[model samples]
Target chain A: MLKAIKGIPLYLLALFLFIVTGLPFLIMFLTSFKGQMEFMTSPWSFPESFSLDNYKLLAELQFFGYFANSLVVSVVSVIIVILIAAMASYPLARLKFRLNRPIFILFMVGMMIPIHTTLVPIFILTNKMGLYDSLFGLIGPYIAFALPISIVIFTQFMRDIPKELEESAKMDGCSHLRLFWSIIFPLLTPAVATVAIYNFIHIWNEFIFALVLTNSTQNATLPIGLREFYGEFSVNIPGIMAALTLGSLPLLLVYFIAQEKIVTGLAAGSVKG
Target chain B: MSRLQEISLDTVHVRKKKKNKDTWVIIGFIAPAFIIYGVYVIYSIFMTFYYSTFDWTGIDANMVFVGLDNYIQLFQDDVFWTSIQNNFLLVIASLLTQLPVGLIMALLLFSPIKGMRLFRSVYFMPFLMSTVAIGILFIFIYEGNYGLLNAILEGIGLESLQTAWIGKESTAIWAVIATVCWQFAPFYMILFRATMVGIPEELYEAADIDGASGWQRFKSITLPLLKPIIITSAILSVIGSLKYFDLIYVMTGGGPNNSTELMATYMYKQTFTNFNMGYGSSISFSMFIIAFIVTVFILLGDRSTRGNG
Candidate 1:
């Protein structure tokens, strides 16, 4: 009985934190189902009826176009990041070269740079390359910004691979390229997963680059699309609510499905730094 | 003696040739990532500084070489100063709120509670959601009329406390800071939780045998062990707070008379909206310097403390 009483404060604290964190999402989800009039009448209350009207309205607005853009940009960037970052890590982690430490430090310093510092020049570069206002423009910056963390993760992981593996492969006359692809690359599955998950979430939701780089709805990623929805549907709160919920859904769904990998991946990605 | 010297020199020549080949291989491996990073990140950073010295609308070719004039103006600019102040405020607020709240939440996950898996899942949801969505959702939650926050306040009979949370300057920064904490606290929780999980079970068992209380165990064992992660989290929060843009931009656009203006937002307005590309580059360059200096200071402090310990 005493133990149970002692547990009450713990439960209360947990429940309080839960509500503080969870209530906005709950409100967002429930409010999304509400009609405009219903939301105005009772913003905090449950919906009058679960309705697909808001979602239907979103589909009419070509919501999936934004989804596809985000998917393409995020996937392309992440794949490129993994392949190239892993390749670079092989040399950086294992090779003995004159500029090795300096180069690694260069990439490490990229982590501390504010993205805004690079924004103007990249914007101009994209424009001059005739790639401004296109999905392709965003990819270059995305890949660039992602390299620092991805390389850090990859190099750290690669350094742990048994040196004997490289020596044995070298005995067979395995070129660096072949050796990387055959031996080092395959062992990077866990780090690759971490890099992929970490970068995907950031890229999918990446705003500033998308905002500056892309000028049209056709090229807009999900974050920009959500803002567009906000602007176009400002009066209809529930409609905006529906867009926010739907916009947030992809990541939320992915998180629920792969909860453990993502949790550990995110932790591992940052903790190593 | 001559034959032996010739053999050693031949081996040296061959070794040099092999070293040259190895260098090529290394360059081949690093070129792709390095070129992309160099152009977009390193090169752009220098170009930003170069752009800062000019008077040119980003759209036009009329480039006047202004020397250090843009940076000079930035020094006297009141709005820039305000944004700097606000950014520091955010840094302090994040460290104060996110770390402790995250630590508490992390501690709760380990408590003797039912449904922790559910708790952990829900707790981590905010971090996964895009900043834009969180910003938009909170805009409504902070809306004066028909807002969830006000409704709850009125229901609990705290009607006087209710106001347009993000509308008035007095409350606007705090409102956004609270949201920032909301979005990020869970991240720190995960970070702290990961570190806490690694702490040995035997230490706690030893503590329990010594009749140490819960708070004592945490203060002595948990806090001491969490030092490294706590430092890591603090660095992240400080740097993140300094460069924060998306949420504040979406929520208020540094509105209610520039109360919530951050360096990034101010830079955006100057460059994109107002077309002061030169001035904007100066602001952004300043942000880079500030973040770099702060990171260096923290790392130095960490190393010095580590050495003493």
Candidate 2:
């Protein structure tokens, strides 16, 4: 009975979680293929015509502007995040500085604070700096926000790098920079991969920063683009569904492909708890 | 003896030279990050307050002091109170749901299962999707007609459970709560499992030698070892829920007579929507205060627990 109980739950949970996670996506995909009447009548049922009409229609609308903006912001932000975080993590982690832990803790504290409290200030500062409407506005906050975890993870990996290895490099007349670039970097692949996946998904899914920072459709990210389907009074359900499917598909592909590292990254990202 | 003094002097000279050289290198590495992060954190916090005191519209700087008025209004406002209540409820619901579900899921994953690698990724998929999409997804799921939730309930002949999930004043909060729980459970599940996996297998062996039942062993060994992680997760949950806005904003928009107005959403409404920027800043100030206090409480709790043990 005990064995049966344990056995039953895993199976049931697996099924429940699978359907729960997969169903919304499935609905979006199917709804995009079906006509309005079919969606209204039988959303759960499969499409009768199997047409690409919805995609073609949305494409004609040139929703691709929003799509391109999203891709650029997420891609650029991810790249910048990886570069800045990788560069910043080194000295804090490896060097013998007095302020290492405290400086890290300060950033960690910054991480712990919610973005809402910081938004007003960011808005004011960015407006003053004339970056409000620019895509580059997010570069600063994105770096600040993503840096703590990236540093923490990188630092953990660095600390774990055997001291003897560094000492050996030192004995061989290598400068610290040379040691970091060659010996330390090549070995930190897993953690770096982990940080990249973590940063990519976060910047991809983020909405608040995107919403406040960008006003025009050309500057907006995918999440804001989807909001166009929602008006003050009414909602265009089918259109929004299509846009959501398009918006989330890239991350979903990444998620499905490189899932384990993403999971570890997500785990580490939230482990401040 | 003369040779020894010469060696000591040589060592001191090398140490001074190395320290002098490394100081510049350290400054090079540390200065840029310090300036950027410092301005972002310290300046932004002050900006929240400065924005709170002004009556200027967003763009132009026609600033006027509404000193203490925003605070007074916030104190008197029913919506603000409701928002605070909602945030507390959110914190409770998160603890209630994320803790057990995450722990159970973690336990199941930890239990020598196959295909967990795939399942772990699958569980995290919703998390990758934007909260906006998830909010939209749950909205349809909770719609009055043709919703998956209602359909499933009606199909099972539990028609009483088929009432409007997000539509009514009564059920909107629960609907939002479910959405929050669904998205975040995987996060805690991973955290708990990671810490759980780090516990030595030998402890379990020792427990078995003492004729400890599975439940007993878990209670005695696992719970004690996992206290730190559990506390950490609880603090995270508290803070996350306290400041939760995006999901609530998208799902219900804190609507149907504002049943779901979380603190963060309320603040957003005041500052941006109502143009009461000062009042919003007051709320943001309070928000900062609440966050600091809550964090302090959790840290103190961590200290006491470790001290007791």
Instruction: Highest lDDT: give the candidate number.
Output: 1
User: Chain A TM-score per candidate?
Assistant: 0.97, 0.89
Residues B1-309 of candidate 2: C-alpha lDDT, one tens digit per residue: 699999999999999899888777667665656666766666788888877776756656677888777778778999989999999999999999988877876776655456866666666677778888888877888888888889889889999988888889999999899889888887788888888878898988877788777688778888887777788789889988988988988888789899989888888887788877677778887888888888888888789878988
TM-score of chain B of each: 0.98, 0.90
Q: Each prediction's Cα RMSD?
A: 1.6, 3.0
Candidate topping TM-score: 1
- lDDT of each residue in A1-273, candidate 2, tens digit only: 012235666677766776776677788777667777777788667889777766676687657887777677777866766665665677777788788788778767765677888888887778779998778887677766777777777877777788899888899889867887798888888877878777877787788878777788667777777776555213446666777788788888877776666777667656631
Q: Stretches of candidate 2 above 4 Å error?
A: A1-6, A171-173, A232-236, B1-14, B110-121, B197-214
Question: Candidate 1, residues B1-309: lDDT per residue as tens digits?
Answer: 699999999999999998999999999999999999999999998999999999888888899999999999999999999999999999999999999999999988888789989999999999989999999999988989778899899999999999999999999999999999999999999999999889989998888889888888888999999999999999999999999999999999999899999999999999999999998999999999999999999999999999999
Candidate 1 — which pairs collide? none
Summarize candidate 1's per-residue lDDT along A91-182 as a digit string, tens digits.
Answer: 99999888999999999999889999999999999999999989999999999999999999999999999899999999999999999998
TM of each candidate vs. truth: 0.98, 0.91
Runs of candidate 1 exceeding 4 Å displacement? A1-5
